[model samples]
Target chain A: MVDEHADPTVGELSEGAILRSILDRLGASNALVGPGDDAAVIAAADGRVVATVDTLVHGPDFRLAWTSAYDLGYKAAAVNLADVAAMGATPTALLVALAMPDSTRLSFVTGIADGLRAACRELAPGCRVEGGDLTVSDTLTVAVTALGALAGRTPVLRSGARPGDVVAVAGELGRAARGLRVLFERFTDAAHLPVPVDESVLAPAERDDLAAQLRPAPPVALGPVACDEGATAMMDVSDGLLLDASRMAAASGVCIALETAALGDDPRSALTGGEDHALLATFPHDRPLPAGFRRIGRVRAQGPDPVLVDGARYEGRAGWDPYRDWDARTG
Target chain B: MVDEHADPTVGELSEGAILRSILDRLGASNALVGPGDDAAVIAAADGRVVATVDTLVHGPDFRLAWTSAYDLGYKAAAVNLADVAAMGATPTALLVALAMPDSTRLSFVTGIADGLRAACRELAPGCRVEGGDLTVSDTLTVAVTALGALAGRTPVLRSGARPGDVVAVAGELGRAARGLRVLFERFTDAAHLPVPVDESVLAPAERDDLAAQLRPAPPVALGPVACDEGATAMMDVSDGLLLDASRMAAASGVCIALETAALGDDPRSALTGGEDHALLATFPHDRPLPAGFRRIGRVRAQGPDPVLVDGARYEGRAGWDPYRDWDARTG
Candidate 1:
């Protein structure tokens, strides 16, 4: 069904041709039987497979004008890997389902493959794309399902937190959210859309922030380390710190007390900012925090609220709610 | 952010409310760790998982005018389960990622969950919905990734066919395509769109045929039976017999010869129709065909063409091509 004579730029090419290109880029090293068969087979060495899925829609989750296809692919892979890592498992393989408009560029599709492969190579060495389905749609969307091997270790759950546990975090806290703000300010009213920006023209910090927003380098390795070191409870922070922390506290039936002093300067940014894809976990109070992790708070007996900001209630808007209508300025 | 008192009928409820409702319906029977966690874990009894993913888009895959969310969900599960069965594996679990417009009715969301659970209960007793994600989008899309257990049996592959193997099929054909024709004709010009039609109003044959198109009942058990009976190669005939047979022939470096008389009445529909999702397989010439299977052809040495009907080349439009564009009549 692949159209060999069709133009790639206008997406007159068939789904088969694009699928083959993506599969060729992936090679499926970890897949026992890769794409082209009825179904792909993968070994679940420990007798179980940890699975998670996330979807990124064009309008709400990303903007084509603000980010390239390569960066979008990188972020998609990072999001799924972070979830698997939060499960205390070794990432194994991914199945991607992509939906796009008929006019989508072939280069954009291949660029997504490149970014997904490179992220898997750098973050999870053995991970690869196993199988996927490509279809036509009005808006471009990417949905990824990631599988992981537990290696016979116990999966850390959010219900395991105790009153005396110490709350900690790995990776940056507010960089990605801050980066989004910068990009929104800079490109809010641009006449020529989706133009390439020269990084040399922007401040060093601004450029770095934009990179963080576009392609988040999640702390995939730190999750297993936290589990091995005996993390009592764990989760990845995609929503703001306070919002996610409240979730943990509610699930575990404990109160999370944040220490503003322990968090970096500008506590509001660290407390309410999100999309960093960082790991937040709790451990026994006496256990020494591992490298790449910093103590941020403590667990306490159930209080009036699930979370306390430096011994007082925080009265501010929390973080991203996917169902809310899209707002250009706030998004 | 789940809202407690928002009206579901008016689309004022939050993402959390709809998600919880769906999870409640799923109940997660096969999940070691189900939804509400970072990820879900499912047992791979034979140390491996047979995985496949497929996406259903709004305009291209289905029209909301002709089918309900329940039928959509049931078809989604059937499509993935058939692929796993084609691999000679037992269906185990599914991870669903759904993207829909914010104005989508809450009943539509929960109805999909009910349909998924019902299909799993009936077709695959032990299989269940493990985890899923729900996000906002302009169009409603469902992507399902199914996992299966091999149960220590070798997977049946399309590449295993050889000269002298007898090709056979174990399920009905042409009915789904015929059913699609009936539906398209009946609902083509309806003014009040997307209204539910009472099956009692239609002729029994038409109702039954429409059911086949909306929800296919694949020969799930026959796949494993064929494998045990030493079938050389197998695949689900999703994209018409001729098209899929050509694929198997090309993969195995052989020619598939078919006898039109062997196919049931209306050979054209049986040979060129798609979406029936019946199992097509080849067994060694000496082995006895399974109880439900009927011999339709033989594998032969490679000829000028991959597939031949009654000793002559047959030509026609093969099957579905997702990127071909949205044509309601053709679909």
Candidate 2:
């Protein structure tokens, strides 16, 4: 359906020319000193900036056959933007550092730029790709640094959770993890290599899960709302609800008790699955939960365990760790 | 002199353990929310933050055989710091995203952390490693994002150069490139593969060049000084004077005239070589130049060429572009 030979590899073009192609797709810059300059100057009107960096490597993070260039870019931006939002801040700009093989197509590069723009426009409206770096590497890597503004609010830290706080969550929980299962089961070959996904063969919910895994729409806007409504603590449930909640509990010196009945149909996946950028926040028991957040748990005094699900310590595996989990493979 | 076997590989350790090791070496937190949080909150006292990103890929950016882990970290931080300084801002923090092979040693990771700390202390005081991300990749890559404060001054842009402006520079011109030549000439085998650098065999000047290439110390503090002293235009000369100046010339819609006589010792290398990281800035003709800055040339109206070396267009290779230069040899 497409002419592969028509697309030029990045190595065949000058760096300036490739840069021009990427810049063309990124739209207008809102920063004071945008893309062309050595650095971008972003307004931090509240005198404080929230910053975070995250990287997506080819083999461990995603497979080229399964992930389009656009999804890669969108996921990279979305992940880092969620980190900033978890700090109760609004993302203003992203600085992406991209390194790829010389054999990478120029069209693929532009596709990434378009996806970055789309993610910024949808997930965090005012955010834009203000700056970036490019280099040649054997492995494809996208390292994105997101910057945010707290807008005169005290950052809601994970250590702020008190014993009487009510735990709540916003955004999808188990969808991304379920999507990972679908990929491994349906789209992987007998040799354990990923193949191109066939969406027509999958049901609607499966398709939703797959989309959630590839192109997540985290509740970035709700982060600020939780802050405005007096959230006691907050964090992004990235490495699974159990693992991240345990981290928050350990930091707060409290015990977290989750109600399994509150979680959707797939409770185990919701508890153990990763790559879900759900905002987990704690609010005062007396106050009503924020508009987008739904109560899922409660914070108790520090006990033997950091997290207790349905009044019992969860005995299953907690979450994914790249060092312990990823098996190096390329398709 | 070092016990390579004593240091455990990162793959054998948990991701949390590796992160703890890196965090241990990064020193105290100057940020509102430092490492260990979902994100770091940094102070932007002047209401604006100057941000920049630069990456060093293993093969094209450096040879692992020639560069130590310490040097790699230092160079990565130094390059990004120079970008922020070129914008006439004081660097405040750095967010590093490091991706490496699974077999990389834990000591090597700590070595990089030490190098990053050392560079921040020596080159840009008050700046610290506020946040970072670590991932596994086939290629070793360091992507650093530096953030700075302008302190209410207008950011100096490359497009502000006008006719009759005095051109000046602050740091080394061709030392880093000369270092690369030294490594290629003396430290490579007949197969063009790099070997470990033997500092004992090199002369003082050669060693200085090597150090300049590996651990550059750009005049970061002078950026704000140049701004305070009324610099009209400025940029970092990372890709050699001719090419970067040509870029400035194009951006400013003027011609940059350089005096080869102003270049010390090796004028040709100074003219064509790259990776200098010197601050190339312009000031009004009336006032005396800043303390660290030395006059080199003057700006002229738009001409046939963007850059004129000694009043004539240079005919040799101007600089290195990874797209056209790299040969994809890992060794």
Q: How well is candidate 2 docked (DockQ)?
A: 0.89
Local accuracy of candidate 1 as per-residue lDDT tens digits, A1-331? 5354443743577767788777777754678888889999998988999999999998778888787889989998999999999888889899899999877877788889888998898888899988888888876899999999888888888888999999999987888887877776676655423444456767988887788788988899888888999999999888889888998999899999989998786677778887878898999999899888899999999989999988888998777677754532443
Give the per-residue lDDT of model 2 (tens digit) for A243-290. Answer: 999999999999999999999899999999999999999999999998
- Candidate 2's TM-score reads 0.98
Off by over 4 Å in 2: A1-6, A329-331, B1-6, B329-331
DockQ of each: 0.72, 0.89
What is residue A281's positional error in candidate 2, in angstroms? 0.7
Tens digit per residue, CA lDDT, model 1, B15-127: 67778888888864667887788899999978999988988888777778777889899988988888999999999899999998877778788878888887787778788
Model 2, C-alpha of B199: deviation from truth (Å): 0.9
What candidate 1 gets wrong by more than 4 Å, as runs, is A1-11, A190-201, A325-331, B1-11, B190-201, B328-331
Q: Tell me what fraction of the real C-alpha contacts between chains A and B each candidate also makes.
A: 0.85, 0.90
Instruction: Please state every model's RMSD to the true fold in angstroms.
Output: 3.4, 1.3
